[model samples]
Target: MLKIEELQKRIDELLLKAGLPRHSVNLCTAPVGDGTPYISFENGKYNYIFSERGYEFFRKITESTDELLYWIMSELAYKIAFKYELENRIEGRDGRRIAFPKFIELMTKINPLWKLKAEDEIKKTLSASPYDDSLYL
Candidate 1:
């Protein structure tokens, strides 16, 4: 299980790095589909929800402090990109569009090693397993 305090700290750091208000972001648990975690913005607060399986996945990917920080930052980038699109804010406050390519570039610039490692971890998780029975369904 991941420590809530640690996760919250990482979230706060990511928010700060993204030029967002730390007070506007929150970490919480909620029911999510397919074990995927998601972020929600309501009442001027951004709630990051983690399902049981999502938390487990997070724990697996974030084995160290540095890894955890990188992962959270990457997630923040993705969420920001999505939010920009949803709100039709193609040009952010800095007059630059926040897109997936930019997100990836930002992540890589933050820590190339950590970003590559994160990608490998995700790839491994998404790869098919030998014990596959869902195909029958």
Candidate 2:
């Protein structure tokens, strides 16, 4: 089972790899969705929100413990999430930092499977735990 704290660490790692400061993830606020693991970023203009369908897929991979399966699932999840970010647009707040949408898009395209795989792993662990809570995005 994946603990929330561990999941958070994985998230932080992804954010760092994505070129987003690790501080961006607000622990005080809910990161994942109602039933899925989703993240939302807001600047001055628009809010960047995305779901973690990849996480659900990840849980399946982890359940089996097949490294190759896990790798493939992880790769796919990140690709889908990154693609969503890329195709979408976000309003930049200060005009200095890259808008959340743009950042997501760029990260996804560069290493679409990186952060996403980690996120999926965490989400899967969360869902499988005894205290299961639905977090659908």
Best candidate (score: lDDT): 1
List runs of model 1 lying over 4 Å from the truth. Answer: 1-3, 29-61, 86-98, 105-137
What are the models' TM-scores?
A: 0.42, 0.29
**Could you give the C-alpha RMSD of every candidate to the true structure, in order shown?**
11.7, 16.1
For candidate 1, write residues 13-125 as lDDT tens digits: 65666566785445544545565554444443434445564353433333355654564577666666567555654322321233444555556655666566645644564
lDDT for each candidate structure: 0.53, 0.40
Clash-forming residue pairs, model 2: 33-135, 34-134, 34-135, 34-136, 35-135, 35-136, 36-135, 36-136, 86-105
State the displacement of the C-alpha of residue 95, model 1, in Å, after optimal TM-score superposition. 18
- The worst-scoring run of ten residues by lDDT in candidate 1 lies at 89-98
Please provide, for model 2 over 50-93, each residue's C-alpha lDDT reduced to its tens digit, 9 standing for 90 to 100.
33533332222222212322343344345455555445524432
TM match of model 1 to true structure: 0.42
Kindly report which residue pairs in candidate 1 clash with one another. none
